[model samples]
Target: MQVVKQLNPLIFLAPLAMLSLPLGAPNSITQSLALLLLAPIAFIATKSAIKKPIFITILIGTLLVSLFQVALNPNKEYSVYQAIRSALPFYLLCAIVVSYKKILARIIAFEDRTPGSVQKLFDRAVRVFATLSFIQTTTFFLGFSLANALSQSENDRVMIFQTTSIVLVFFYSIIRRNFINIFLTSIVIIGTGSKAIFVATLLLTFFAAYSRPKFSMLLKIVGGTLILGGTLFYFNPLVIERLAEFAINSDGEKFKDATREYEIEQAKETLLENPATTVLGAGFAMQVSHGVPSLDPAWEENSKYDIENGYWGALVKLGFFFTMLFALSIAKGLPRDEFLMAILLVQSVMFMKTSYQLFAYMDGVCMLLWSICMVAINKINANRNSHQSQFQQSIQR
Candidate 1:
């Protein structure tokens, strides 16, 4: 309880969104919790972004267009609620979180004032989350179920938030060449069957280790690739359970996500459906449909959008101009740290798979944003400690 209390407001919404379990770490529950945290977040962000006019303008533009977008929607009642829930994650990042350079700077300053308080809280929270995630993964592998991992489909589980802290450890293990953590974290991540997360982690790990390019690093990469390739072609447990989806699913077909191409075509049609939708954007929960027979099994109804692709997702919702503007706005807030930058770089490629950056799943957005915050805390403290050590050594001399 005290550990949660010790969390700096900058990272508060993140943990709150991730740990929100009623919806089983899905977007709905996380967004609901994020909405609850918005008031305090907005208060903090107002103070934090006082000097950042771009952020203020972006917020204003979003609200104005969103109001217009909502009014234009035929299903106003549901759309109003849908729009609010979808955007809450974006609103709740009030470190305001997207302003990474400034927010991380504030966190560093807090560390200076309080010594090790925030870092300790962060580490402790991550340990708890990582353990829960590991247990869930283990349970899934052992032919059982826990919580809501298999609620949607046999092999499908969205544990992005739960796996996020562990991904940070996975990221750091590559940086430090810690084989034990690298192996353990790898299993938990891949077991979740998250293509975006696993691929992002693997790519970043490769880039970081490639900088050194030792024999061992190359050998690790080759060995790892071969193993993964083998599993994919051979006895992959992750998908083995998916066969059960057909037998148990009422639809009498295996539940599956729409292909990225299918989602893209549907989104394009919806975007160009009318001049108002084109110019102002479709307000909240706008459902796109096609004549295709198979449907997104996760949804109660088949309303698919190309939201898995962050850019395409935004384009459908906010039009070209606003979407591009939002993109630029995010660019302004990206971290300057090389390591953090590398993670974002990989995710950019995988945006076609999922959008953890903007209004994807609240849990994932919270998890990833929280993971970045944790990385910043650790990196800043380590650098400061190193400088302090050097200064003491100089004084002794």
Candidate 2:
């Protein structure tokens, strides 16, 4: 028991460390292996806590849907397999959240001992990665062969870095609002060349700032935005150009719209062909190849055309009812805060252009945030109880 207590913090760090690693190389493998190792520990730690009925229902429902889909659409064997693989981590993370309150408390205790330690670590990591990315970008411009091996492309690196940073900012913002973290994270988001993420981050920033509605806080936000904007413009003028490009009707915008329309049309045709499949989803991996082709050949196999839109992806795999259940389950599980709600709303919009499965690495980061919130809430309640007890005792005396 003592040994387990000593190692508890390390378990939480495993996911963060895995997320920090380069994308598509060893990151996925390491995360899976770590989860496989940690699952038993998490279960042992929190098994005594009363299980939430809704989580159980959702878990069972998702599994049943996967199985039903597999049975009905045996041709989509690989799709079902991939979907299950993609979803397993999310379900596992939920189980960890439900059972690992003790571990969560331990992490919170560690944070209390060293205030801002997590945020500092996150900032340092982002800086290190960003520096490497900048060097690589510079070298590529200079026509250096070493640039290829130095770092991932700016677009890929920013996406990975920002995903990790957003998780940190989300949790840190909840604990203590800091403009520096938000500013740095915004820089990372802008580096992605993703207008949607930039807009989403902007909306989330305003939502978080307006939550307090203090004059000083509003001033800081405005001042920080100006500094951040100017710094980006001075250092990387292209970022400003990219942001400006979103407003204009360009060939890129036309191509993007055409692709989205084509994909939606194909989804409509596929659903119409087999109306019954619309209920539970043509059983995970029932491919509809009538639309846009995937650049990744793995997605092309088994008749699946990589659905970029998350909502459409969910609709394709889980169908209407299960999708609602899944969405509700996620909503129920998250910490109740307007900031978080705004973040989720923004993510939902961003998902229209990208695919983010529930079992993805970003979900792991979210699970950590949820655990931290739970610990904070518990502490607050405990303090309230203690204060009330003391008051009552004094009155009686």
Candidate 3:
């Protein structure tokens, strides 16, 4: 398909989609708005993709999986109509993002466009969100926020994945490495107190360090971080408390205080109960009846403990075949650029923590990652290839 003469409307939605407000702002509103807004973009992108067999073909494989999901029934407890009605939105979200990726890939990879403000703008939007959330968390830790604020702030920490993911990408994508964003997201991660993010951070730092003038600098960086971390630990009692929870207790159990102990067990039972459901999940996006009692009864329909864990969420929802298909699509389609590669690496680590990519919740953040990935892949690879061609011509000359 020919590149559109006009800019993709995603530029306007990109920031809106990524904007998850900080300081206990109503995220349900934002999440709804994000999905609501993307509905048309999904339609538009799909319509555009239809004209081009190549772009549509890329998503046809996965869209079919989402389609077949509408029919597959491993657990008779849920209705067939339930899959079509309930999974409609979920399917739409996945389609929109996948379609956008292919379109953006065409623009970036083959169309010879350079990484432009469209991307930096999305990064900047998330960067601001991450920084505000970081400040929000810091203030909460310092005892400035209301008693009710921490849950959302902690949820904001979940979003640090997006912030941190963006931070890692800019190291190789944007002009003049985004050190400020990197610094902000890193501190937010400390508040995360998540071993997954911590592990990913260490590996990211290792790779970043490896690229430094001397490999020996890794020692100095780690040592300095440890010392600073110790200093921060003393002052940040809340951080100390968060980290302490991860430590083994007198009972010799680790993560005793961890939430989702129930969700973990539920997901395991659901997946292991039947080989049919195990290989093919109970069904796509089946709303759990007892999702969250504290919220509206209607909201409970969205509840499924299975979703809390990314691996199980994807596995229990799409089962093995489609889950791997979705993963391989992301893996195969992404360009060989460090910026995108770093995000994928961190996301790989995040599979243990959340279902951002797998289940398609918090998908605006997922869109940001995918959008950035396509932009980077398209622009970086295209530019690199062009330069290589020019270099070959020069050699021949």
In candidate 2, the residue pairs with backbone N, CA or C atoms under 3 Å apart (3 or more residues apart, or in different chains) clash, namely 46-99, 69-283
Best by lDDT: 1
Residue-wise C-alpha lDDT for candidate 1, range 234-303, written one tens digit per residue: 6455543443542355565454444655667777887898876776566455554442445555442323
Off by over 4 Å in 2: 2-10, 21-50, 74-81, 93-157, 161-183, 237-247, 251-256, 271-275, 288-291, 294-296, 299-305, 357-397
Each candidate structure's TM-score, on Cα atoms with residue i matched to residue i, is 0.74, 0.70, 0.68
lDDT of each: 0.57, 0.53, 0.52
**Predicted candidate 3 versus true structure: per-residue lDDT over 1-397, tens digit per residue:** 2434445543433544244344344444544555565555556655754654444543454445445544564453444444443354445544544555565554453334434644555556656655665675565556554211212343333333244443353343222345565555556656555566566666666665655546456565566457536754664445555556567756778766343555566677767767866775556534432344545553355454335566766777666766665566455544455555566667677676665444434442443444443354446555778999999999999
Question: What RMSD does model 2 have?
Answer: 5.8
C-alpha-based local distance difference test score of model 1: 0.57
Backbone clash count for every predicted candidate, in the order shown:
1, 2, 2
Among these predicted structures, which one has the highest TM-score?
Answer: 1
Give the least accurate 10-residue stretch of model 3, judged by summed lDDT.
146-155
Candidate 2 lDDT by residue in tens digits, 295-336: 646435522544556677667656787677666655655555
